[model samples]
Target: MKQSTDKIAVLIISAIKGGGAERSVLTLGQGFHELGYKVHILRFKSLTEYDLNPNLAYHLLKFKPYKLIPNERFRHKLFARAIDNFIEKKIGKPDIILSNLEPSDRVMVHSKLPNIMYIIRNNISNKFRLTDNNKLENKISKLQNIYRKHPCVCVSKGVENDLQARLGPHITSTTIYNPFDKQLIKQMSNELYSTPHSVLKPNQYIVHVGSFTYQKAHDVLLKAYAQSSKAYPLVLLGKGKMFDETKALAKSLGIDDKVIFLGFNKNPYPYMKHSRGLVLSSRFEGFVRVIPEALTLDTPVISTDCPSGPSEMLPASSLVPVDDIDALAIKMKELMAEPQSFRVSLDESFLPKNIAQQYIDYLTS
Candidate 1:
């Protein structure tokens, strides 16, 4: 489809109010506005705290149609229907509707509008997993038949492969890694770096910034941190059901004293900047966005070589085998002993200005 020349209105939808996917949408909205396009955000619920460029305009839809579904079995079907109505009514047929999360994404693509292009940006790895239960074939068909035949941009190559393998190469998806604002990253880094080490307190602390969820493998992270003989603090930043379970696990490991659950803090950069190194123990990722942010902040990183992201994000020498407590611990140890050399080779592709250009191309072309 040829790129439309108009005001270029874009409507984005997401499930939750925060996290990497939410932040990515907000950053892109700001970038879109900077490119002189009109942008609007339609969220299912409400945001606790979020940052968006003040100039950008948005609309919020607050409804629990997903909750009204008789049960979880056909909940996705009902949720998609609800979003369809919202797009038809409030959205008023934008140039494009961008769905960034599950259920909502399925709905937007299923609308089958010819004038309005539906762009579904895959936010999780499980959505594209090839399996009978996943219903990938049916979903792909629905997308192609319904939406105005726009591209499906998976955030990571692993996600792209899973889609291609299950749905076949004919569906061809693009892998667009998330972009970061290099200037903002450098600004944040400089601001954090200038703070006195005495005030920031260079305590023996390792930071993990992500929701307390299964994909994050926080259980394994806490366990690995517990096994560390080196006496250092392990700080977790995020709120979820797993928070309590993780606390109990720490207590059971007899290392609860070493773990500090900071809950969710708006500004984690200061803590991340002053920490020994950032640790990520995810089962899989499109690309772990936080790892790059940590590197930008000059924080050394110790991550599990999880499917798709870590091996690509970090050098072969920097990654530990996924779910291997011993390997994770060893890398953590190595980083703590010699941090500067490890961070010198950080990747620059994620910088915001570079990423903004990619979005501009997507929107314009």
Candidate 2:
């Protein structure tokens, strides 16, 4: 499976929508492009919002999945053909194909494409525990079938272990921690942020950067914030279905005025830079990027010791128990009182070029 430097690598994803997974795809595209691969992002849906790279290419090929077909295999095969045909016409045959998210995996596993692999960005087993408790084994059997078709690359070791612990040794996959351009993140964090309302002052507010989703456990954060010392305002950055609901929760907690909801800024690094510290209270996570992102800006950070990610990079002092409001509140008070930031001691293997090479090597080997 070895290839020349000028090879084509098509990244299949749901959309270029914002989130950690989407950001990872775009950043990896740059990594592939930099390595002299003709990198292209082929999204089934056209929900674009993130900053695009000039060196990379993107194609939106929307096709209706044949769900009405009686046979599951036949319909998925038909869908995969549409994806293959889209690549055949839009670009030359790709040297390798990497699919991300559940949307792509739903059909791309049936794809007869070349050297295809799936990138797992979530705690799949934990998600099953939350969503499919009644028929967990059957759901895992379905996933086992998917892995049999194309191997996977998990974003964290905990994610890999969780899958293997359930799916067993028969699965084909490896862990590759998410890559970050630290200097770029630091540079962007230096940019001054202007707001329409009262401005955000440096070291005067506590910040949390995550979409208002159940997975983010915003309710826990709100409860904990209300119990904290309230030395600084709590700034919530990001927007989703849970936005209004989270706002309502803040009001219910009687901390509405003390909580700031700044919905979905393209760049949240400045807020991370200026905040006293960052907090992530996710119920589960793949790789908590903000934990490291805040560390990159030298901002003190704390997170729930969720299923994955946090403990991998964060020291014990920076972690609180998942879904524990009291524990989080105590730590929140600690952060407000102290200005200490952790040293960014991430692995050099997490660099873009190194990570890109690892992907290539994984496919070739």
Candidate 3:
């Protein structure tokens, strides 16, 4: 068996934060460190605030150190090229390069480096909108051709299937589920996972933990919560630019008081563990890790049976038709009315350490 000391540096690039892919990369980097590997994470731009383990070595490929100054058209291109070239030179020939953030095209430039593997970790599914679907299908098709010359990995089997279906067999891809620290999640849950909104001195409430974006379908979630016959407060956590529209929708539906927007907070485990049950109304997903997260906390879940994940992760009894606010409302009411019977545990077969070993085996093979 090859010890972790034999492992070379695994580099993960981040354009910015506040995305599942970014969060997964950070979590994986921490896992690598825990496994006694020499791990290094490189970011295109310096992070303003990142929650990361202090032991890992993080590199920010910034042109200017003092402040983040956005470069102009040509200058931005040159800056990007410079960063790519700098990564190739200073990284001392990495064993693998994990691309998690946007503009995945940057990997094409670094593909020049010899003896280094490429792992493409994607989190979102390609079924949201027509415009995005068109763009992604095209780009992913091109990436498929590129991967024929050099292979890479995908985040989930759903994403792998979508890639192969769109780009054809020329793309070589395999699914590696996101790795979350089970011990850490347990500890975090134990410390912070209090009854939903215990801080607010309340016990009956519905919780949603995700960015306030359209893909999350907060509008439908709120509409469903409003329509639900159960009389309980709804807590919407996480921050985003779309808050005003979602808030406005709640007011229009005349349930503004019933819905509470808690903005963004790093520690949402407490809110999640304490809530009556989690309500996720995503349009699509590569795989919803939060489904398992909620289950690990023994929190009941009521999710829209979306394309690739929620239904597959949770029991069929917990799922409802996508965009069907009536069904969603009914499901939420069912869980709320029967909290004792609703609580359930997530399957442990796909735990983080096991998933990490799967990736390692595939990469080494």
Colliding residue pairs in candidate 2: none
Q: Return the top candidate by TM-score.
A: 2
Candidate 1 deviation (Cα RMSD): 4.8
RMSD, every candidate, angstroms: 4.8, 2.5, 4.4
Point out the worst 10-residue segment of candidate 2 by lDDT.
Answer: 339-348
- Give a tens-digit lDDT track for model 1, residues 311-348: 76678777888789887777777766766646734666
Ranking by lDDT: 2, 3, 1
Give Cα distance to truth, residue 364, candidate 2, Å.
1.8
TM-score of 1: 0.81
Model 1: colliding residue pairs: 112-146, 180-351, 180-352, 181-352, 182-352
- What does the lDDT come to for candidate 3? 0.66
* Count of steric clashes across candidates, in order: 5, 0, 3
Residues 184-217 of candidate 2: C-alpha lDDT, one tens digit per residue = 7888888889865474688899899998898999
Per-candidate TM-scores read 0.81, 0.94, 0.84
Q: For candidate 3, what is the TM-score?
A: 0.84
Higher-scoring candidate on lDDT, 2 or 3:
2
- Candidate 1 ranges with C-alpha deviation above 4 Å: 1-6, 65-93, 112-149, 185-200, 344-349, 360-365
